[model samples]
Target: MSGQRRTATRSEHALEDLDGAALSYAARFAEQSEGRRRDHLRDELVQLALPFAGRLARRYRGRGEPLEDLEQVARLGLVKAVDRYDPERGSFTAYAAVTITGEIKRHFRDRTWGVHVPRRLQDLTIEVSQATAVLTSELSRSPTVAELAARLETSEEDILAALESAAGYTPASLNGPVGDDGPAELGDMFGALDADLESVDDRLTVSGLLYRLPARERRILAMRFYGNYTQSDIAAEFGISQMHVSRLLSRTLTWLRQAMLTDTPPRWESTGAPPEPPDAVTVSVDRADGRVQVGIRGELDRSAAERVRCALVDVVCAAGTDEVLVDLDGVGFIDAAGIAALLASHEAARRAAVRLRIADPQPYVRRSLIVAGLAPLFT
Candidate 1:
């Protein structure tokens, strides 16, 4: 015990010697003129105080920041103290120790948190941590939130919030391993892809396609699929035979499938109704200037599309006709079927080495062609 006391006494004497030397240097440094001599004095002062700054930095070790980084901060603070020290005010040793410790604390307050935290919460977090350590030592166990709150003289809610905010100081990485024995990571524990999300686009597409169908057919589809009605029930509701309902369902589904596959959908037609008479659509063909002009009148819908297609194909396939112009000045409306008919005629003309063009389409017809991506054919 006597030897230990002697060692501590010698250590205190050494510290006193260091403090006296540092004070004398600081006083001389402040008195000296601004030159190499003064700079040399200031540098010597910093060198003399380095071990003290290093000891202060060590107090902050195991607090998430690297020891090297803390030491760097402390050295910076020591330099600042040397440059701004006033020998008349107080001891240089006391001023530098405060400056260096404050610098280290400020580094933790501002730079260590992984996420932005309110200054109040940050200070509270440190208080809570210190309180936890003290309470754990006093009670020999972790303290409850109420005990912490009483010790900190704050509400339990504030203590809880501080504890939660403390987690933001060092967030766990998602890429980190989940367990000690396996390759699985923390990210792998998250929820998997939702199967229903994959069908969102298809559902939207089908909704638009369903709107394009005739009202009766739309109702039939809704009853069968949405209402969960059987084919016989649908046939009974519509006053049609079960076989007819079956055939209509088959054809409608086939058309919907084909429509969904293509950028442009097919036009809907009623199989129960009789075909439109040939006189409903008029096709007039005239040969002029080595080109056949085929003038079509009336609505170029599904009813008239086939007839128009056949007439245009015949004119295009004629050996003498090098070019054919299909005029649509009188056609008030056109549908997907009409566009399909025009496409078929264009294909036939291509095979026959004849140039087919569209001319004099009305405003509505022109817009329809543009929408169907056939405006270039008219130009």
Candidate 2:
């Protein structure tokens, strides 16, 4: 009894503190004009009432409503209550509680239903539910519709309608477990896949948008957007700074969004002349799904090393591929110059946060990399 009294006293003290804070904030709000100070006081006022609103929200939880979402709705309600509250009307705590509870109830009435139904049935469904649970506990079994009606002091017809409307509270999952004793799922009863796959249009749209970007840009987008990599993570991969990644991402996405709005080719693609082919090495860049494949077919010696290095670095940065597979199967040799190119590309990929790999290296090429002690780097 002593412990309970102490807890109650502590709660009372906390409430008093909150009330004092709120009144102070209100006084400050009235004194200030439209400025940062007034906004700050208003925010502090809302913060003070959030705890009370949270308690009110928890009362309406667990009927398939997410508590976090309810709390957010309740917080919004508290803000409204704090805005409209008058000290002359009643205590701020009582007024805020009523406002917050109304918001939560409004959430259930307007948004919680998975399927549309009559508003009267929707409200009665909640009443019927509460009555059913109480009667079930008292009788030690599920209550009949007639018993629920009697308990709720409603007609049997109204009880049946509300019970039927209860299905709108939660939509049944197609993949949910089915049958009392079997392992079958609800989806197992369905037929074959839909002939028109839903992802086709999305895939085509994304593919079209991605194709407009250079290989390095594509790889960056893939890493940042598709891979959910942070700017710092991408910077570490590409050996670039986080600021550079941020600018690159911002500019690229802005361009894409603008192009989408205008329904025209982006400025990069609008240039009259096509990009000149790399002179020293033959470079072919291809993107499928989210992967960028760069095929290099030629002797990777000093004469072609710089070209190869530049081509590779460009591809790694621009490809927008989750994983870059460099097909080195056609390469006949690799000297120090070629090794330098490989190392440079590898380091660049590391900084950009791109996945760079040497795919199907020929035996001679492998020996050259291994001999130069560079084999471990290209995986």
Candidate 3:
């Protein structure tokens, strides 16, 4: 007990020394009149009082607000306190603590809540929180709602309502882990009736059909639909006849139709409009001297392939020229899908009986085309 008392005395002496240092800094800060000296003094005082602010901020940790963010808020409060503090009014520690707590409370009130809640409930929640902390200290246990109501001089119903609304302060993720060493999520505990299961059934049928296809065949489809590869490009990649690629694609598409017919695909409802396609490629057409020039920009990968293919086809088909020139000068990247898109465009140009020339491709793009055995076509 004597050793405990000695330790307590040392702690008290240490606190007193801290208070003396803070007070000295604050006096120096307040004495300077709007100069670098004043700024320097203010910095010194703020740095001195930062630990106090940090301690105040730590009170609200693990409530979803990151400790770092809370500390930032507290530091701002300390700066305000240092600027507004009057040594004549009160001790800097007490003033700074109040200011920092107010900042943290304001942070919750203004920013932390995920959903809208009433102003009265918000104020009461903060009040209840403060009362709970104080009561927990005084009683050595969490206070009951009745006890909380008594402390705050409010009804038990109001205390309960505030407690309920406390959930709005930090809305938890359904994906968050809860029980220790458990594989289940919060989402797993709940289920809602989905009226759209019929649509899901149709999608699953089509998805299963596609997934069941051979990897190479699926890749070809991806090149055609997702990668925007022409049948000719796909054929060249596989060292097969273009007619074979065309037949394979047609068979796959027919399978999709058969599955959809069996499943009775649902008509899209008007509750929401279809999403707009993303702008992954840009195309500009210039016609001059019995030739049409098409300028393409952006990465020509799987994502952009379909758009690029369509743009090339439309431009080439519409151009009443002996030669259609595709200028890929602005294109930065190209992939297998992009090569397929170009080959598809070439096929479309052939059907229209027009010459399609790939002109001024970037060095890497030209290298890719050459490697893909389409160098002669481009020249």
Candidate 4:
């Protein structure tokens, strides 16, 4: 044992001597003029100090960084020390050791964290880690938050925050396996698909389209879908037949489906037309000088809206017609369904590059259009 101690002492002395010689050489190299000779001497100095830098880098091993990368950082620091060293200020050996160690530490602090943490918290994390290790060894167990805070001379909140920040240093990969035996990933545990989320878009779309329907039809839809009422129940509440309720529901649903699928919503048709015959609405078309005049005569209610819209669309689609005038003077009354049909025909005319204008509308029909916000389009 005595012989081994002596041998170790000799090895230490030999290293000390080598370090002294290298420092002396570095000082000489710094004094040389900037030329090939100086460059050669600088290279020699770097080669001589490489082993010392490697030793400093080895002190940081098993710290998540690769040994080769740490050594590279240390060697870079050594080169900087050699270039910036002023021999008169201090000893090169001590200065180079500090510079290299600091470079290695900075590499870990700046680059190794998976998430950005404040500098203060990062330092606190290190101090807390060292304190926990020491306390665990002394007490033979993990230290509590209060114990850690006391040892670090900080509040328990700060200690807890530091503990949380430490996790940012090396976060687990989301793609990593959950366990040794499990095939699932860490991300798989986060959440599953929400069945209702798939219908969220449909719900939003239908909510907007529902207002376009007549109030009775809208009520019927709400009663059936939202209130979960049977057709017979809705029929009894509305004082209508079950067949009428079913027809209204079917028509409302079909219009909503078409509205959701298309940029232009289809015109609405009412199921409760008061036994009025189809001849109640009449349409006449006359063309002259590249213009077509369409005359509509009737109440222009839901029962007549679809017929008037179809006739106007046919007139607009006809070739060689640049302008269409819809005469609603003979119409005595109009409703939401009638307004929707006119708007639909206007949209069709606009797409077909034909100019369509409303020539005349009765006072009631004009007021209805104004209330529906369609008067501007007609004007």
Total clashing pairs for each candidate = 0, 22, 1, 0
Query: Over the stretch 286-373, how does candidate 3's per-residue lDDT look in tens digits?
Result: 8888789999876687888998899999988898887899998877567799899999999999999999898888666788899988
Q: Compared with the true structure, what per-residue lDDT tens digits does model 2 show for residues 58-95?
A: 88787778999999999999989888977668678888
Segments of candidate 4 deviating more than 4 angstroms: 1-14, 18-23, 134-158, 178-191, 194-197, 214-379
Candidate 1 has a TM-score of 0.53
User: For model 3, what is the error of residue 355's alpha carbon versus the real structure, in angstroms, after optimal superposition?
Assistant: 72
lDDT of 1 by residue, 116-161 (tens): 9999999999899999999999999999999999999999999999
Rank ordering of all candidates by TM-score, starting from the highest: 4, 1, 2, 3
lDDT for 336 in candidate 4 is 82
Candidate 1 residue spans exceeding 4 A from truth: 1-14, 17-19, 131-161, 190-197, 214-258, 269-379
**Better candidate number, 2 or 3, judged by lDDT:** 3
1 or 2, greater by lDDT = 1
lDDT by candidate, in order shown:
0.84, 0.79, 0.80, 0.82
User: Residue 43 CA error for candidate 2 (Å)?
Assistant: 1.0
Model 4 quality (TM-score): 0.53
- After best superposition, candidate 4 residue 148: deviation in angstroms? 4.4
C-alpha TM-score for every candidate: 0.53, 0.42, 0.36, 0.53
Q: Ten consecutive residues with minimal summed lDDT in candidate 2?
A: 270-279
